[model samples]
Target: MHTPIEGFSKLTKAEKIDWLSENCTTDAEKTKQLLKRYWNANSSVQKIHDEFIENTVSNYYLPFAIAPNFLINNALYAIPMAIEESSVVAAASKAAKFWLDKGGFKTTVLGTEKVGQVHFMYTGNKKKLLQFFETIKASFFEDTKAITQNMKKRGGGIKDLELRDKTDKLANYYQLHCTFETLDAMGANFINSCLEQFSKTLQKEADVYFDFSADEKQLEVVMSILSNYVPNCIVKAEVSCKIKELDEDELSGQKFAEKMLQAIDIAKAETYRAVTHNKGIMNGIDAVVLATGNDFRAVEAGIHAYASKTGEYSSLTHAEIKDGVFRFWIEIPLALGTVGGLTSLHPLVKLSLEILQKPNAEELMQIVAVAGLAQNFAALRSLVTTGIQKGHMKMHLLNMLNQLGATEQEKQQLVAHFKDNAVTNASVKEALEKIQTH
Candidate 1:
């Protein structure tokens, strides 16, 4: 059995790798070789990657791709996506091209407010607590004045503060709910710094409040942090055209519009369908989010929370065909920043932002929204017409072949064969076996 080790982080990179390979692998030298093979050719670049995270392991890579012909708000853009999935970029590009002649995507930033909270417990009189909060609310801002100085200069700072009583739900539980406008930065650190200060002030003030009883004076700060549920930081992206113009090669315009609307209705009504439907939207959203070096996980959490905001889980993308026109759109909460965190530090992130024409926070929000809206449009179109697997499986073919250890000639032959044949695991295996036999 392997034993736990201490002071592992104190070891040098080479020593760490050596220890890990020996203790964790069946073939130590091969493990080292595989890890080293992924290192950047330039030592300086490799060193940068090493410092990106702890453990100092070799770099893990994902494909960086571009989807061209995106015309958003009367501007053309070639959006960059970094993802391991194969069909996402292709689908997004296809949708963008489809909408190019139909007035492309139009987007608007709905709001740019974010949220944070300070939770505490005080077994005090509710009315007295409320009065105390009204008196000290100004101090919350005053305490964090230095921290919010730069954000204020940028026209973004504390928006509001409220004292929420949750004593009925959890005894003596209360929250100092706050709202903020961070402008070009995600402002997580700034919001959190301000919240921590507010928490300290709340405890300190409660300790000496004249009206508080001895028990009420016992204010316990639970936690102070930024919330991932940002309903106010929202953006909307949409595409619309005459229903008669919805024509593709095989499907009639009216038929296509009707079928697309029906598919969306089913997705909105059924929970199972809605989950996958929203996931398809996120495929495009997350690709761009990851490429830009923003927190995709935070974006994902906030978006899904927004999806269920209406009491039931449902589709994020909505479709409607009326007045001889077909309209599809999505409005999602996205707290994105274009000027901070890894946006300036990561080389690829900087390049991705540059490719996006150096958009501000609101512009980036619109762009990301367009990506998601385009992706869902492509997915629904395929589902209502030729079906989804045809494109998805075709994109997946190369990965299947690579996994089988097929040579160049075999991959070429199999690629051609699968073009006319159905793609499935058993069929692929059989085709490869037959090719090898010959």
Candidate 2:
């Protein structure tokens, strides 16, 4: 993949499409088929009627432009995100530009290890099962090691094991929590396989029939299928930039920082506000996750659960100003993928990965972390400076213009007019009439 054009805004729609095609691999036929699937139209019929013909699916593909000018950890990156929401890309680009003008975004990613858990439940006496696990802990772990020999060789292995018991007068059950450090891989498939094998070994050793699947319907008590709670492997980064413009506005960096902190505080204090607050961060993360074909739903669930882990829903990121510079930081559970599964299936997902130059899973995670932080900054800046509606409503008006069937020139005039006057159906109708008369 090559660098984007210097002034992409100057190009026509066709030119932009052509430029993207040249810089990155494009399967026009596949894209058309996907769009057709989205439109719920037969590919054969649409091929004859529509300029862009393909199969119909349940979802439509809409492209938004991801602008450049980001300096992350002293490196320049052109982050291209695919999303349908308005202002996300533009807001991120603006935030990145702000950082670049000051200094740059300084970032540091921790390790490349992800945690996977295998849960086990015992149907036998809870005390007996607990004692059995304690007695054979070393042997069981050794067997686990044998299964994950390759991973151990790569400096990753079963890190720890713990037991939790729930007992009452009627019944008792114990849980075996096995934690593994999966290095640079999603590791769910591998971890599950290892757990299945270990479960058999435990059953054989104890001479007890362990009901791996406990039916909650029949028995008043049951065991967990598996807990998706990620291990405490934290990823952290900090971005600091000197805001000379804030000084010019008679706003000391300290005051600006206080304002930003207040906004963040407000976001954390209310679930209503925190929902949109986190959505901004997801705007950046989901795009990258979608492009890589990872399970965005799993990531979302883990992140939201993490956000409320403290018993109060709050923002995962924080911002402040110190010593005439703005500083922002975020730490979140961003379990994502760079390769395997749908990343290898769909053509466009593969193409987006190619444009990213095939970053390893760790690098992909780092970039995702940066995007989340940038998106957070965008949201706060808008809330503090010009209202968020200015940019959001502007993009929305363009979408309305598309629905009105205004020609390119008419669209330009209508956009300019709407900027000065409030937008209404009557205003749109008047513009349409003028276009027809002309």
lDDT of each: 0.91, 0.67
Query: Counting only residues 3 or more apart in sequence or on different chains, how many pairs clash (N, Cα, C under 3 Å) in candidate 1?
Result: 0
TM-score for each prediction? 0.97, 0.76
Query: How many angstroms is residue 315 displaced in model 2 relative to the true structure, after the best TM-score fit?
Result: 1.0
In terms of lDDT, the best-performing candidate is: 1
Write down the RMSD of all candidates, one decimal each.
1.4, 11.2
For model 2, what is the error of residue 118's alpha carbon versus the real structure, in angstroms, after optimal superposition?
4.3
What TM-score does candidate 2 reach? 0.76
lDDT of 1 at 293: 86
| Candidate 1 structure quality by residue, lDDT tens digits, 66-149 | 999999999999999999987999999999999999899999999999999999987757788888889888888899999999
* Deviation from native of the Cα of residue 15 in model 1, angstroms: 1.4
